[model samples]
Structures are given as structure tokens and as C-alpha cells.
Target: MKHLRYVPGLVARGAALAAALAAAGLPLVAAAQDLRGPLGAAPAAPAAPAGPRNMSESVAAVVNDEIISTYDLAQRMRLLIATSGVQPTQENLPQFQREALISLIDERLQLQELRRVEKERKINIVADEEDVDRQLGELAQQSNLRPEAFVTALRGQGINPDTLREQIRAEISWRRWIQGYYGSRLRIGEDQVTLVQQRLAAAASKPQYQVSEVFIDANRVGGMQAATAGAQQLVQQLQQGAPFPAVARQFSAAATAATGGDAGWVSPGEMPPEVDAALEQLRPGQLSAPIPVRDGVYIVYLRDKRGGAGGTLVNLKQAAVALPQGATPGDEAAARVKLEAIRTQATGCNDLEAVAGRAQGVVAGDLGEAEVSDLIPAFQEAANQLQVGQISQPVRSPAGLHVLAVCGKRAAGAAQLDREQIENRLYGQQLSMIARRAMRDLRNSATIETR
Candidate 1:
């Protein structure tokens, strides 16, 4: 139910790559002629060879039939360095160049796979003008440049404007391809939603314990023994009743150290496996033994515990009324009146659907039991103030006016999640892994030649 926004950097990368590919004369764009510079303006020439060619040099790697040129690799390195703001030092140039070349090769492979899938699936994926314009706008904003200024800057950097646009197009195309091929099949079922809701409800009701922890970064230390020894000393201090927060502030390497390593309120599953195991055996106000975490060790102390019925539940229904085609005063008033009538007839939560049905003009949706925070702010506020089984007045949100009903409530505390919720979470993780593997496979088989 959480709405996520697109990251600007991701959009920029896609756009930049599209531009680069377009410049390379790749068959990514259908209307290539439209992207060409002004008539009579000379095409930008490719950079000259930096060194003599060796005839006997073997192929670095082959992706299908395409060849990756050494020259292309060098250019990609320079561009990556310039874009990332990483200094192109003599000591780091070779390493950076190697990684950049690999990344380019992977990108090409993904593009090839996307094209193949699109053809086989007969998918029509188009990047609209608005999408491109938005990406361009974001990129320009980041660089404090106007669209025209950004294009000019690309030209100054030996990057053709068409090339950049093509790069963005390719990235968008690939994302669309992925969505078409796999997104629909990736689903979270009703049971999973219910389970998460229950788990959240339980977590809210459970006692919240304040704890201070010291985490020794084993990865930074020489070995596990060094980390263990550090943790042992910290535990000894805690046993002697030394203040945990002061110790943590002085020695903990984690970001939480700034807050004296205070982890606000941790539920059982929220803590690391080892830490959770240790805490399970300790009573409130108890100090845990050194707990091993990946590449580190932690010493935790239970500072205090607060108990309260914390969870809230809502039994709600929605009526989606379409706005009139044209926004006239009469149309608005009619819609408002219809919605108000539905609210007035609904005696309680049980009557919500009946009232909606009788209204005839409105469509009803059931949102069953939901957490307050899970609903939109306006809806959450309305639900919070209503008593169980109470019907609310019609409220206007962007989607339309919704008449909500609070059928029931549940107090917060820890509770076991249902199987459906567990499976859904697992499935989500599986889908992520699948996507990553697909990308990796494409990268491995791609043929790229860099200069």
C-alpha cells in the first residue's frame, strides 16, 4: 500500500545511457531521423585511435556476434569518471576502467535480451515524450542547467545529444520489458496482506524495551578473535554496572553510536538472529552476552520497558464515484449530494455496502481490516476518531469522495503472522533474486568491445 517515488539518479543514469547509445548509431530508436542535429551541421567525428593496432590480439570476450572494442572501453571509463566526480588517478584508472567496461558490457547484454523478449512476446513498449522530458528536466535540475544548456554541455564533452537520449530510451525499454514479462506474475496474495497486518498489530501491542548496544566492526578488525575480545571487555563493563550508552558512544562503530547506540524499540524478529537469541534468554533490565553478528559482535543491555495496547485496526469500505467529464459547478454539486446521501443512509459498517448499492451511481470497494498508518492520512484520521461500527460522513480525496465505516478495532501487540503473509514476503524476495540473476546472466553473455 506504500507509494514509492522514482529516484532522480536512476532516471539520470537511464537517460545518460540512452543518449550514449543513440550517439553510437544503435537501432534503439525508431525515429532516428527526428533525433539528428540541424541540416548542414557536420556530424561529430569519433575520437581517433590512441595507439597502433595489433593484428594477432585475441578477442577479450564475445557477446553473441558483437565485439567490444578497447577504444570503447577507454571512452566509457573517461565518461564514468567525469560523471561520478571520481578523480581519474593513475593508481585507480586501470581498476576503474576495467569495472566500467564490464558494466557497459552488462548493459548491452540486458538491452539485447530486452529486444529478444519484446519480439517474442510481441510487446509494444514505447517511451513517451513526457517520460523523456521528465528525465531531462531532472538531469538539468541536478546540474543547475537548463535543457538546452545540458545538451550543449554534452556536445562540449564530445557526447552527442542523440546518444544521451537513446541511452535513456534503452533503459526505459528494458524496465518496460521486465514489467511486461514478469511483473504481472509477481503477486502478493490476500492472505499475505492479512498476515502482515496481524504481525504489525502484534508488534504494536508488545512491550517496547529501550536498549543500548556496542557493535565492534569485525570486518575492520584483524580477525574474529579481536572482535570477540573487544565485545568481551564491553560486556565486562556492563556487568560492573558501567553506563551502557556512554560505553557505546565511545566505542560503537555503527551509525546508531551518535545516539549512544540506542535502538528505540526492537521487536523479536527485528533484531539480528544472534542478538535476538541472546535477548530471548535475558529478562527486562538484563545485559546480554556478546552476540555474534556478520563480521561483528554486539553487547546489548535492556535499559527499560514500556507496555501499552498500541495497535489500531480499521474496518472500512470505499465508494469510487467518477467525476463528471467536464468540471462544471452543477456536476460537482450533484456528485457531492449523491455521496452525502450514501453516508446518511448507512446506519453502521454492516450497512455500508447496502447503502452504496442503493445509491446506484457510486461503486463500492472493501478494504476489510487495515492499520491506521496503512490508509491515506485523511482516511486514517477519520477512522481514528470514529467508534467501532460507526459510519463516517462522505470525505473528498483525489480519487473521489469516500464514505468510511469503522467496523472494529484491535489493540497493538506481537502476534504470529499468518502463512499467507510469510509466503508473500518470501515470494517478493524470490522475485528480487530472480531479477538480479537475469541481469547477471545477460551481463555474462554480452559481447562488448571497448577502445
Candidate 2:
């Protein structure tokens, strides 16, 4: 099942609820800075933007009775730019606007459907202030900022917290509606769980792929041509640095769209043949083009993979020297010598940071709990050979030399699945299909006007 059920707590994947979802790598703005990627107050006169004029634009889009004004459009753009940390050049702004407009349109459709469902069922699904607060708190945690400070930062960026709240409300409300309506009928027999266990046990030694998904529903289109074109555009935007999770949250018709399209760790047999073939062609951090299937177009991002199923995850730290600009082979050689010396001195995990501090251009920090495949190839190999409290010899990369230490490791296995886990698995599989159909019907009936 698609894992899009996380409430506002998921900032990125954890960010699943936040706008510009999955914005962990993006720096948050300060209380005083206006949304321009860390630039502070300016006394100097601002230069004119050297591009085609987009000023004087009016209402950008309309969904049913709701209007998204030019300011709303601009604010949304600024919010995306601010939170994503992906600066839009003149070259890509038009494309960004197109995708952004599409996303906003989809957001409206989702919220509208949520409202309609509530009215139809005589349910009150409004997101209260407390719900908004919790959502903000989760988003702040992803950026390592306090919730109040995060709110202040967002306001500084001209992004209304209420807009974020509405998004959260929509996410939460729609999920509740799906569960309330279909969850009762969604069931997993004990026999089904046993069958899955037997299959997994048999294939325990085979490779498993950890993946996230972005599905564009072409089946809803009046024509396959238009759907194909829309899917292609999404592929282009993702290639151009749009956050996959954010796009999924805004536009995916799948239920896991709520969790930012996280499908969790899927094995070869679990995935469709078309998807498996596509997965074979990409490595970790790579995305596939739109793979046209019978019902929709799928663009999958490979998170990581392993030779076997779940294994030990380690808490790791690294101490490294950042090579100076224009450093030569001799300079690299000197850095490696220093790293080896540091390696001996930083033999223990606790000593790693201090050893790095003594070296020039060395930056030391934690790598967090992660699997071997989660690291770069060289680091993965070196880590696999090390024991807890053991420090690696200098690992070389273009940036510089590095030494790593393993703080701890823990087992992660298939036995972790309990009855509740099995039920959720069943729920998600059924819910995604139901959610997709519901969204399709909603879109089919909606009156959307684009400028």
C-alpha cells in the first residue's frame, strides 16, 4: 500500500504535510528575511528583474466559485522558491509557473472535494486552530526550527500560515473521509497475511527496492494524448528540480499522495512488470520518465536497494577535510596523510569531531542512522567492513579525505510486521484505488477556469 497516511507530522517525507513538502534540504527563512533564499534586508536600490514582464497579471486561475488571484499566485511562487531553495532562473520561470498553476488547481480540487464530501455526509471537517498548530510544529521540526519561529519565518516570506493550514486540513480531512467511507470494507484475512509471509520468506534473499512514487492519472483524461502530454510536462519539471513529494502531494490522484507518494520498500514480485523493468534502469536518487500503464502514468524515484531484505541500520559520523579550490595531486596527497593521522587519533566515535576540528578545511558531523546502500559506494564498502567503535582509514573522494566511525547498529527485519501493520497494509492498497477513483469523479464534475 502507498504510505500517504501520515498526518501533518511528515515534513519532506516527514515533510509530507508541509507545503513544498520534503523541504529538508531547503533552508528556512529568518524572521526578518523576505523569501529570497537567505538574502537579508537591502538598503541598496533593487535592480529591475532582467526578463520578460510578468507584472499586471490578474486572476491566475479559478476553481468552481473560488478565485486564485495574481497575488495568491505570486505568493505561492515565492513560497515554493523560498521553501524549495531551488531558485527559478529566467529560463525556467514560465515552466515553473505552468506547473505551479497546475498544482494550485489540484489543491483546490482536493479541498473542494473535501468540502463537498463533508456537506454530503453532514460532517464537519474543518481544520481547527489546534490542528494548524500541530501541522506547523511538525513542519518546524523538519527544519530544526521552533514552531513559533517557523510561523514567523513563513509570514516573513509572505506565505500565510492559514494557507498552509488549509492544505493540512484538506490532507487530513480527505484521508479521514477515505477511511470513514472505505476502511470498513477494506480487510485482510489472516490467511492473506500468512500467504504474504510465506512468499516473503521464500524470496528473502532477493533484492528489494525502497521507492517513492508520483502517479499522474491519465485515465481521467478525455483523451490519452492530453494525459500523455500532461504526464510528460510533470516529468520535465521533476527533472528541473521540483520536489517530487511536493508535486505528489499537490497533484497525485493516489491515496499515498498524502504521504508524498512513499510506497515503502517494495520487492520485485510486489511491483508490476512495467515498474520493475523501469526500476532496473535507474539507480538510487534517479527518477524514471512517465511509464504509461493501463490506468495512469508512473514516475518512480529509487530511494535505495539492498541485496537482501531489512538489515542493520547504523548511527554514523564522519570527519573530513574539504579540499581547497585549485588543489593539486600533491595537496590531495597531503590531505590524505593528515586524514590517516586523524583516523588514528579519532579511533573512537566520540573523538571524531575533535580530530576534524584540528585539521584545516575539515568538517565533521553525524551521518545519522542509515543503511549501507544509503551511503556513497566507497563509504558503503568501508562501513560494511567496520565494527562498532571502529574508525575507518581515510576514504577518498573528490571533495577530500574522510574517516568514518560507527556509533551503533540495530536489526530491522520482516518480523516487525504485526496484525495492525498487516491491516494498515491492506487499508492503504484499497484506499489508494478508491481515492484515485473519487478524485477522478470529482475532477470530472468540477468547473475549472485557467487564465
Candidate 3:
């Protein structure tokens, strides 16, 4: 029941490609326009192209006789910008492109590895298009739009949703391939789970950080100097309002980079003394200076923190009727009317979910379990008095009017959190380590050439 914010970073790495061109002072094939579509107003483009012809025909990088065409990189960048809200400005473009190229290289290596392993084992990686369709529909729903309208909106912005599809495919395929290739080996023993559970119990009442990281590996040829420079640029890019998740996707060597470098709710004691002290000095939404850690340098983003985390972990479901941006009096009135009808008709989570399904610009979702300290002070105070099966009066946020129903709540205890959560976290770290090593090995063994 962790209140985790999930921002899939696989496609965000695609934005890294344009970063390559920018770093080299090369212009993009086309100037990025005022893009307002599915995600938001995307950033501008990179350097202008060499000529009129499509860069798709031009080679960007070559891998084992395989080609990553310029067209691929350009389209990937556009889609990533459209989705992740990362802007590509002149100053940051080069750095972004450099990171993109690296991600692209890693992606190419992964695809190659997946295919080779598939062929050797006589296995197929099946990712149903239906799943993609479902995901697309769900994404469209988040914006309070229909699936086809969402695609049309993206098309209007010159962003192709297919690029997103391919990115999702790569993630799906890589996960399936890894699971198939290393099935039982990923499992944790009972003793290991118990130890993890014990640690959680001991650290349950300490200060915790919602941390994200961008890591630059010094193990490569140029050593610490080159790596430090990379970290410096990454920090600057982030400071300039680049989405941390996208940058992390493009640059982090750790497995968490796959999920935007999210190291969910780490207690202060869990962090190294240097990292812990660095975090202690910062407030939420601030970045740390590049910290040297063994073979690499890490730039951490402190997202949120808790001071002595003892509290109720409340789980609530909300049905919100969102007014359009720049809503007029009439729009607010209409939204209020709709919300009133919904509030009266919906008495439980299932009922509210139905109302959300039928109402446009409505959101029906579990707010995730959060410590009482984590909730906004006002909302926390209001929710504190409610028992299970109780609903709160409409709370006004800028987005719209929300009616929240307490789905469940409990005092923090070992039993409230299960073994699976701990196991998955452990397994994810293990998988990420293995994946990075596998990718490194593939790069070492492969004949890669850049154009």
C-alpha cells in the first residue's frame, strides 16, 4: 500500500536521442513547435538538419550490422517530449542528446540480446497489441479524452503514438525475456524475506526520503574527470527544469533508472553517511551536488521526506469532477452540479468508480496508502476523524472538486505491509544489477560503431 508515484521512464530515454544532436551543435530535422497535446507543451527541438531529406534514411548509430536511423531517434524524441513533459532547449539539447544516444545504444543492445536469446531458446516474446490498446485507452482516460481523440491530439502536435508503443514493447519484451531467461533464479528465500521484513520493522519509525538519482559511471575510459563532467551537466540540465525522470532514464546506470531512479521511501540510516548528510541539508524538490560513490558519481533528487514516520496509513478512493482549465462560471457550476449528483449517488468505491467512468474529466483512483504526516495538513486533519467506510466532504483543489471516501486505514504495523512488497523491491534491485551487468557485457562483446 505504498503511495508511490509511477512514471514509466523507458520512453523518456527516447528523448535522449535529440540530446545527442544538441551536444554536437547539430540542429534537429525540424524545429519543435508549440506542442500542447496528450502530455503538455513539449520543449523545442534541437539543431536544424543537414538537408531536406528525412533523417530516418540517415544512420545515427550502428550496432552489429543493425542500424538506428536518424528518423528513429527524431520520432523517439518527439514522442518522449510529448509524454514526459521534458523540454529540449538549446543549452540542454546537447547534453540531452548525449544521454539519448547512450540509452539508444543500451536499448539496441537489449533488443539484440533479447532476439538472440529468443532464437537460441526457440522462444517467442509475446506482447499482445491488445495490451497496448488497453494502455493507450487508459492513458487517454487520464486526460479525460477518448483513445482516438488522444491519438488525433498527438498527431496534431507531430508526435506519433506508435513511438510510445514501440517503447512499451521494448519494456514488455525485455521484462518477459528476463523473466523467461532467469525464472526461478530471481526468487527470494523465506529467510531473506524475513530479514527484509525485520529491517522494515526496525526502520519503520525513522526519517525517510523519497529519492531519485542520476548516476554517471566512472568505470569507462575517461575515468572520474569525464564522469564528473557528465554528472555536472546532468545536474545543470535538471536545475533548468528538465524532468528528473526523463534525465534519469537517459543517464542513470542503476536499475532504478528504468523507473526514473525512484528509490522509494528509504530511511536515513539506509543511505550512506555522505548521501544521508547531503539529503539532510536539502528540502523537497531540490537536487544534491554530484556525490562521488565508488566507481561512479550520483546526483540525487530529494522528492519528499518524512520526519519520524509513526502514523496511520490511510487508503482513500476519490471521484473528482475536474473543471476545464481557465474554467468560467458556467463551467464551474456544471462541474459542481455533476459532482453533487455523483456525491449523492456514489456511496462506496465501486459506485464512485462507476461515476468516474461515465463522467468526462473525472478521476476515480485509490489515493494510495500514505502516512498521516505525508498528507497535506488540512486533508490529514479532516481524514483523521473518519473511520473505515466514511466519506469526506468535497475538498477543493485547483484541478477540480473532489469527494474522497476512506476505503481502508490502519495503524502502521508489520502485518499491514506484506512480504510481496519487500520481495519485489529486493527482486527489482537484483534484476537491475543483473540487467546492467548483462548490458555491459553485451557492449563489451559487440562491435558497435557510431556515425
lDDT tens digits, residues 332-366, model 2? 88878887888877768888898888887778999
List, residue by residue over 111-150, the lDDT tens digit for candidate 3: 7888777788887774569866766666666655677766
Candidate 2 TM-score, true structure as reference: 0.59
Name the runs in model 2 displaced over 4 angstroms: 1-57, 83-85, 90-95, 110-122, 141-148, 190-205, 219-262, 283-286, 308-420
Q: lDDT of candidate 2?
A: 0.65
Summarize candidate 1's per-residue lDDT along 163-203 as a digit string, tens digits: 44544665566556555566556766776667656655666
Once model 3 is optimally superposed onto the true structure by TM-score, how far is the C-alpha of residue 28 displaced, in angstroms?
11
**Model 3: lDDT of residue 381:** 68
